[model samples]
Target: MNDSDRNPIEDTRFGEITVRQDGQNGLEVEGEGIPRVTLERDPESEVDRQIAIGTRDPDRLTMRIDGLEVGLKPAKGGLTRRSYRVDVEYRGADYRLVPDSVPGSRLTRDGVHIGDFSCDGDEIVLAEWKEGADIRPEDASIGYALASAFGTGGQPMWMLLIDAVGLATP
Candidate 1:
């Protein structure tokens, strides 16, 4: 869908942000203080999955955001759990995009909850955000990456059902 066709996300810090699919494996996000962000999933990642942000080196699985080279990795939650983790690399900086069992994910810095996002239909809504927290373009970019890569829309109904069952089990 075109940017005009997609619903814009109203964020507290960035204002109205638009997200759209660039192609089969890429997503584009636009907003204030946020450069037009693009994330592309590597196709030959049957074993080692990776995402390339903007013009980052695909082989390195790392991207430069605001002068910091960040590494993105998807770790399996477990054999049964469908959740995954995205880790950003920096000295003493612990950034993670932790998925909620439902539709979206929580952005945590050093294990502190700072932002919450949810998927409603085709739109991603920022449910909650901590005031005065250091908001950066990379933060929103990571959220879009997670939603595009691991959101419920990409899963089959049967897999979703299994995930629901798994959540209910423990």
Candidate 2:
């Protein structure tokens, strides 16, 4: 998948995005006319340090991230097909980000169920106004346990956008 035209590295851009493919895995995006960009998708961040009763606790968390699914349709004479699904649980709520089904409602990547979108010349706005039901664990301490259990975390939005743009561009 590495193109020779990309001498030292393979890179492509659309608008303000410059992407470099990561073999068959995914893409790395950068600003077109700027330095590298790091997208911070962690709502609570990797670590929150403060005095917990004049002390401190090392904060940790993990996200249940799934891999991409791709295949070929049998009935369509070997036509290629792809689907993207991302599941994230934060603050006792489940956030699922998948492709907009042809007959489905709207949702954003940040786990907003009911929302509105507006467009201008070169900008898009997305919002979820509905206060959906809250999801909680059986035991309140389970969240904390799981949070500290995983040393690393998953970046769902980063995965979705990188996969979508990478697969589509090249």
Q: What is the C-alpha lDDT of each candidate?
A: 0.56, 0.26
TM-scores, all candidates, are: 0.62, 0.23
Clash pairs for candidate 1: none
Q: Which residue pairs in candidate 2 have backbone atoms (N, alpha carbon, C) closer than 3 angstroms, thus clashing?
A: none
Q: Write the per-residue lDDT of candidate 1 for residues 103-131, one digit (tens) a residue.
A: 56677777777777665423454546777
State which candidate has the highest TM-score.
Answer: 1
lDDT of 2 by residue, 64-159 (tens): 211212111111111111122223343444433333432122323245453221211011122223355332221111111111221112234556
Evaluate residue 114 in candidate 2 and report its C-alpha lDDT on the 0 to 100 scale. 37
Top candidate by lDDT? 1
Q: After superposition, how far is residue 7 of candidate 2 from its true place, in Å?
A: 14
